[model samples]
Target: VNTHGNTDFRNLFSQLIQKPEEDLELDRAALYLAGEEYPEVDVLSHLAQLDAFAAQVSQRVTHETAPANLARAIADYLFGELGFDGNSGRYYSPENSFLNRVLETRTGIPITLSLLFLEVARRLGVRCSGVGLPGHFIVGLDDTGEYLDPFNAGAPLSMEDCRALVDRMSAGSLEWTDQFLEPYTKRDILFRILNNLKAVYMQGREYTKAVGVIQRMSIISPGLPSLYQEQAWCHAEQQEFRLAIGTLEAYLQEAGTPDDSKEVKDQIKGLWSTLSRLN
Candidate 1:
C-alpha cells in the first residue's frame, strides 16, 4: 500500500519537473499531473517548508540591512539548508526557468522573498507586488511607490537594468518599452500564464490547445494586438480561413502605422486572398 502511494507521488513530481515551463496549463495540467497519486502527506508540504523558511528570514530583516546582504543570507538558507541548487554564479534562480514553481504553489513566496531583501533601502518600506512580465513573472518592490524588480536576486538595478534583461532574453532584437515597466494587476498575471501556455502549445504543434489558450488570453487582454495575431495564425494553420481573416482584420485595426504594420497588412491581404480561393 505504501509502495503505490510513494510511486504515485514520484510520478507526479517527475511529470511536473519534466513539463516544459511554457506549456504549463495550471488547472488542467495540475489536475492531470497531480491526479495520478498522492501520499498521505500533502504534496504542498515542500512549499510549506519554503514558506516557513521565508517567514524566519523575514523576521530578521530590518530597514538597516542592505538589499544585497539580505539576499545573500536568504540565498544561503535556501541553497544550503533547504537544498535548492543555486546555479554556478549564486546570483539567479535555476538558470532559464522562471520561478513559477515556487511562486504558484507558494503564493507569498515572491512578496516575502522581496521583503526579506528590501530592508536595504531606507527611503521607504517596499511593498511587493507580482508582475507577469512577458516571458517571465517578476516581483515588483514598490519603494516609497517606485516599482523595482527584486527577482534580479538582490542586485539593485535601474530602469536600464530591466531593459537590458529584456534585451538579453529577447536575444537583443526586441526593444523594451515604458509599458513593460508599468505595474500589472493580478488579472494581467493570469493572462501572462495563459500566454506562456499558448507558446508551449504552439511549439508542440498542439494547435487546438494553443488556440484555446489564446482565446482565454484575448478575454483578459482584449486590446493586445499580438494575441489576435497569434489566434489568426493558429486558425490559419487549421484551415479555418474565415476565422483567421476576422482575427487578422481585428489585429490590423488595433495595430498602428509602422513597418511592422505594413508587413502585417500585406500578410492579412494575402490571407484574405487565400480565403477567397478556398471559398
Candidate 2:
C-alpha cells in the first residue's frame, strides 16, 4: 500500500471505532477495509460509483413509488445488468471477501454480494438490513421484511423459502429458527465478513493476512480481547514471536480479568518459552 492508502486504512478504522454504534457507515467502512488490499484503489471513487448507480437506478424507477418496485429494479440492475453474483466455483477464495475485487470481477460470496446490494439499495433511498443466516448471508427490506438473496441473482425469497434453503444447505439436518432471519447490524456484518476473510487466510497459511483481518476486527470492536488474542496466535503462526508476545500482553492488559489474566499469563509464558527456543 502507498502512504495515502496506509493513512486511509488507519483513518478508516479510527473513524469506524469512534462513531456511535448506531450511526456507523458500515458499507463505506467495509469498502475502505477492502481497499487496503488494493493500494491503487480510490475508495471514495467507488462510493461515488455507488451513488452514480443509484442515480441511474432512480432514472429507471422514476415512475414507480413502491419499495418492492425499487427492490426489483435494484435486483435487476445489480444482478442482471451489472452481473454481480456469487462466486460458487471458488467458494472459499479470499478475493471474494474484498469489495474492490468483488466490484471489479462482479462476483463474491453471499455476504459480500449482499453488502453491495444493501449499499446500493441504501444509496437509492430504499431501506435495507443484513440477514445473518446460518451459513449464508442475505439482505432484507426494512418496512416489508422481504428478503433478497444476492447470491442467487438477487432473488426474492419468502421466510419459508429461506427456511427451505437452509434445510437444503444443511442436508435437512439443521433446524430452522427465526433468529437466523434477525437483522444484523453494521458491526455484526463487518465482524462476520472479517471472520470469513480470517478463515480464508488461515486456511491458506497466510498468517500475516490473517493478522491483518484481525486488526480490522479489533478496529471494529476495540474492547474485544479475543480478537487481540487471535492476532497473537496469527503472529505466532507466522513465526513472529515478539509480535505474538506483545499482542498477547496487550490482550491481557486491556481485556483480561483476574482469573482470565492468570490464564493469559500461562499462555504468555508458553509464548515466551517458544520465543526463547526460536532465538
Best by lDDT: 2
Model 2 lDDT per residue over 121-152, tens place = 88878889999888889899998888989999
Top of the candidates by TM-score: 2
What is the lDDT of every predicted structure here?
A: 0.50, 0.83
Error of 2 at 167 (Å): 2.2
Clashes (N, CA, C under 3 Å) per candidate = 0, 0
TM-score of each: 0.47, 0.91
Q: Candidate 1 — which residues are off by over 4 angstroms?
A: 1-53, 59-126, 130-138, 144-160, 163-180, 223-229, 239-279
Give per-residue CA lDDT, model 1, range 97-188, as digits (tens): 22334333321223323332232221123344554444544445554323334443444456666677778868887777877767655344
Candidate 2 stretches greater than 4 Å from native: 1-7, 256-259
**Distance from true location, Cα of 252 in model 2, Å:** 1.5
